[model samples]
Target: MLLASYKAIRPGMQGIANRLIRWRLDGDYSHNEVVFEPGDGVDHLMPDGTCEPDASGALWCASSVAWERLPATSPRRPGHRGGVRFKRIKLDPAHWDLVKYRRDPLAAAQHFKRREGALYDWQLILGFVAWLFRHKASRDTCSEVCTEAGGQLEGHRVDPCTLHQIVAAEDRHFRSLLWLAAAGEEAAY
Candidate 1:
């Protein structure tokens, strides 16, 4: 699953920035994250043949080397004015095998963990403003981290929306799971 950061823009000039980002990126999503596993408290069969919450098995998320184990039902990002959405990608058998058997997701998450001290790529953001897609080895963006974890090497200078677009285009398995407004209200579309 993917978690996106999309906020509702109020009227007047303050909304301009949000509008601009949406327009420039051609998408409402500004950030992305991967859900590695189901969290405890959620009903699911376990390998131990036991029926209980998996405290260590909570919804595991990896973002740019920072790992967060959240409750299964926790809001994507609580108390933030920005909205959040979750998406599920139904991979084909081949990709599924690659992910499951090869443990690509875990490897990707580990790759980010290995580079935990990396700084956020502020210059890359500047490049985005300048419409430049230049790569920097020292700094990294969230999307770049995620893509790298997913075994995609072409994420050196990609933004969140661009990353989503590229993956969605290359693979036809993307699907929306849920959408939550800034007020924590849920919606179908």
Candidate 2:
């Protein structure tokens, strides 16, 4: 229902919605959850579970965080509707990165184009970090992964390098995911 509602409100923001769902969790490595205000959303589907009108929501799901947290249902807060609310959400880790993958297609297709700088950059980084678990080698093998799309691996605050977490690891991991999409265009043949 969240995805459907998201698609309805702003078809383009579906990617954002996907990440928002992933953000409902909290744990060690990363706390990626969205605490919703009562009636704000996410509870419309499970009106029975939540008596709070503006409940703060959180999404504590992922590979690394799985270490400490349990499924959202078992250990969820008292006000929460438990996993029954998200029972249908696809918990597969592969899909976990789908939000990251759709960034470019949605952008290149020109679906969502607004805002700039850190917020924009973090959108990409969050998605990339969602699935980016590798050595800091995105720079050497990939050019688009650099900050500003194409330039020397100079001093930049964010980029694939940052999210990839290396000396050159800028906070622009989000762009790196978009770069991945741009590069994929070549392989379409």
Go through the candidates in order and give the clash count of each.
3, 34
Model 2 scores a TM of 0.20
Model 2 spans > 4 angstroms off: 1-30, 44-48, 51-64, 71-189
Worst 10 residues of 1 by lDDT: 94-103
- Give me the overall lDDT of model 2: 0.26
lDDT by residue (tens digit), candidate 1, 1-189: 333333356366546755776677787555555544432221232223232324543333444421222223323342222222222223233222211112254465456445554555556656777857555676666677767767767666666677666666544432222222423453333
Single out the weakest 10-residue window by summed lDDT for candidate 2. Answer: 111-120
Tell me the deviation in Å of residue 185 in model 1.
42
Report the Cα lDDT for residue 160, model 2.
25
Which tens-of-lDDT digit does each residue in 25-133 have in candidate 2? 2211121211222333334223244414333333311111111222333323323321111222332343322122211222211110111111112333344456553
Q: Give the C-alpha miss distance for residue 135 in model 2, angstroms.
A: 11
RMSD in angstroms, candidate 2?
18.3
